[model samples]
Target: MIEMTRVSSPSDIIGIRDLQALNLKQNITAEEAIDQGFLTAAFTIEYLQEMNVASPSIIAKVGDKVVGYALVATKEIRNGHDLIEGLFDAIDKSAYKGKLLKDVNYVVVGQLCVAKEYRGQDLVQKLYGHFKDCLSKEYTYLITDIAQANTRSLKAHKKRGFQIINELVYGEVKWDIVLWDWNLTD
Candidate 1:
């Protein structure tokens, strides 16, 4: 059985890093990336450790083996990583430009990936759902940016109710800044 939960132990952190490495190396083709999703940027273990210390990431595991993960970050916690810090700054500027997302508490989905063997199993949605269940009360939105080339990730995120809130180009790559409002009142 697959279990989705927050990273809580050293083994969980290692598992996430291992799975991230595997996914990064496996999905090389554009078709493969579009079909299974791909992660371009890499994170050091030290960086992940700091992120977990601030806000634990979500992991999907089966029998003690991690198959997927979604890294988490708050506004204050993201400044430690240069790339993420830049992204947050761009997001802040874009948010200000639109005059939306004001005075709202939010969390960033820093990175998300699934192991090649686990791609079709819906682990991504499960991980995000569990993360939201654990954190939505404290955060008004779940935000992330997806590269324009990453169609699979963008489609899946949209299917899960995330909307494109802004667009920006950074590092020569176009990104869609997506958001999921957690505080929607029906």
Candidate 2:
């Protein structure tokens, strides 16, 4: 049976490992999915471990086999306030200024991946549902950015009701920084 669980505690190491392995094989390390200028799949394992203990995140599994994972940043960066300020300044000064940024309690989607064997099983869609359920209480909404060339993720996110609120250009690549306002009041 498949289950969605809040990833909290060291015992969840196995699930994180499984997610990392799946991500390495299909998304980052795979030639067809090489995403340069972004964190590699290898980093996802540590990211999950950190997020599981540090923030609101979820891990999906089937009998100890991790099939998918999602991360939400419901809290502010503890000591990275300066970094956030700099990022916002750069963004505001850029062409995408005067944009709306509401219910943006989450800063990033550290990682969201499914095992290759589990692809096309609607696991990702289910994971999105679970993630929304988990975060809607403590957080207003979630936000994430994707490379414009990443068509699969962009399509999936759009289908999930995320709108492209702003576009960012970094180095030689352009990113579509989207926002999904989960808070109806906002």
Candidate 3:
């Protein structure tokens, strides 16, 4: 049976790293990346462990193997990431209606991915649903940035109820800062 839960053991973190390596932009072919989507950030074991301590990343596991993940991030964790730091600044200047995003209760979805074998099985959808159930009580909104060129991932997120709240270019890639407002749903 598949289980959806937060990272607990060191081996679970290692499983996440194993999945991340196969999906990272640098590790895959350009064609494959454009077709299957990719993870822009490469997280170290130390960082994953740190993130686990702050807010455990949610994962889908079958026995000992991690098949999918939705990385949960606190404000401190988001601010500390070099790639996501720019988003923190952009969101501080952006708002959901009248209030600044930074002015409200929120958390970031640092990165999300499913193992290649698990794709097309609705595991991504299940992971986000589980992620929301895990965090919606404490956070008013779930914010995440996706590479604009990644239509597959973007479509998946939008279908999950995330709306693009802002757009910012970081380096050559333009990112859409998407927000899933739990307040609106509540």
Candidate 4:
């Protein structure tokens, strides 16, 4: 009974936070990180609430339980957080196919995660497809960064049509900035 939809209620926000807690790099062990991928930044419900206000998240739910999510961070999020600002700064200096990314119309995937029980069910791709279906009209690309060591995430993004557009180090962690251009993918 899993369904794909936008974040529509306060509980969905908490669901995202709960799932994120289980998948963070520090929360998982090194072995699990290598095998399952990992998230770096830790965000509060307040921050997620703010981001959702500007752009609602794509989520996979079963009834009221959120099993997975792809959070969209529009330009309204820039300069409001330290780590995000660094990502934006790097994106501003980055180029894809000779055109600077800053000059392109895009939104960042603030965070993505699927509950452990929901993994291996093609839920990741399902969430991304929902992103395109809902956001492609307003945005040309969906952009985000994955830690270089988070190979699982990088491969998944590439498999989902995201291209590595740039790279940078923030908080001493090297990240691969990726983008899926809907104009090209759609």
Candidate 5:
């Protein structure tokens, strides 16, 4: 059985490897981690510091072994591509019924991953369930961005009721970024 749990520290190094593994499994480039020799190792130390002090990062484990992780944060965007900026504008317009996002609360899902062996079993939904149970009480909105080419993740999120609200591009990498939202109010 799979289990979801909160991360206690950013320096909780075991999770760093799990996150790296998940990234690799999903075919996401871990260039930043790979190019910087000891940087990946040091990132664990820093991650612990960040999570220990920050309010939104969480990690998943199954029986003492870390298998997946996620991070959620609340913030506003002031600048970005046209589609991105427009999406926020749309969110702001709807969030307030023509008001602003200043009064609304949003939970941004920064990262989410599952073990390869566990992928097709709906573990992703369980992870989101855990996130929703824990975070829904505090925030009314959840948002995440997926690489446009990542059809698997796109389908997964869609199955969970998330809607595609916008699309944008990440500079040099030329990756297509698709924004999705889940309204927890209902």
Candidate 6:
């Protein structure tokens, strides 16, 4: 039985990191990435621990084994990481059209990955749904970027109600900045 829940222990952190490493290793080609969404950036144990400190990541577990994870990042937390900071800078100038992203109550899905066995099960939507359930009350939106080559991820996000708000080049890779707005009052 697969269960979706918040990260609650130290071992869950390690499992998240290990899943990330496995996804990175498999993300060498667009074809592979299309088959299964890939992670572009790597996160250290310390970084994961720190990010989780602010808001615990969502994890999918099956009988005590973690099969997937989605990391969360806030504005203050993004500032502590150079890569995330750069992404936010680009987002501020491009996605928000010169408006500061910090002005919005949003969260970044720093990374998301599901194990091979867990693919084709709608786990991505399940994870994002859990994220929304836990955060939408406090945040107006969720933001993240997918590599231009990652059509699978792009399509999945779109299917999940995320819109492509902007496009930018980072680390020499083209990215599609996506946003899922929870607040519809506007």
The residue-by-residue lDDT of candidate 2 on 1-186, one tens digit each, is 779887765656666665566455344554546432222334445544555556756777787666777655333432233322333433333332254444234444655676667767777678778887766776554666666877777877787877786776654667676666675432
lDDT of 4 at 172: 91
> Which regions of candidate 2 are displaced past 4 Å?
21-31, 34-47, 75-104, 184-186
> Model 3 residue 65 lDDT?
99
Q: Highest lDDT among the candidates is held by which one? A: 3
User: Once superposed on the true structure, which residue ranges of model 1 sit more than 4 Å away at CA?
Assistant: 25-27, 96-102
Using lDDT as the yardstick, the better of models 1 and 2 is 1
List, residue by residue over 16-95, the lDDT tens digit for candidate 4: 99988888888999999999888888789999898899989999999999999998888888766788888888887988
Ten residues in a row with the worst lDDT in model 1? 94-103
Q: Tally clashes: model 5.
A: 3
Q: Is candidate 1 or candidate 3 better by lDDT?
A: 3
Stretches off by above 4 angstroms in model 3 are none
Please list the residue runs of candidate 4 whose C-alpha ends up more than 4 Å from where it truly belongs after superposition.
none
- Tens-place lDDT per residue, model 6, 84-167, is 887777666653544666577778898888998888899999999999999999987889888998888888888888898888
Instruction: Quote model 4's TM-score.
Output: 0.96
Number of the candidate with higher TM-score, 2 or 4: 4
Off by over 4 Å in 5: 9-13, 21-48, 76-103, 172-186
Q: Give the candidate order by descending TM-score.
A: 4, 3, 1, 6, 2, 5
lDDT tens string, model 1, 76-184?
A: 6777777688678776766622465545678889999888877788877888898889899888788899998888999889877888888878778799999887765
Per residue, candidate 3 scores C-alpha lDDT tens digits across 126-167 of 988888899988988888899999999999998889999999
Better of 1 and 4 by TM-score: 4
- Backbone clashes in model 4, listed as residue pairs: none
lDDT of each: 0.82, 0.59, 0.89, 0.88, 0.53, 0.84
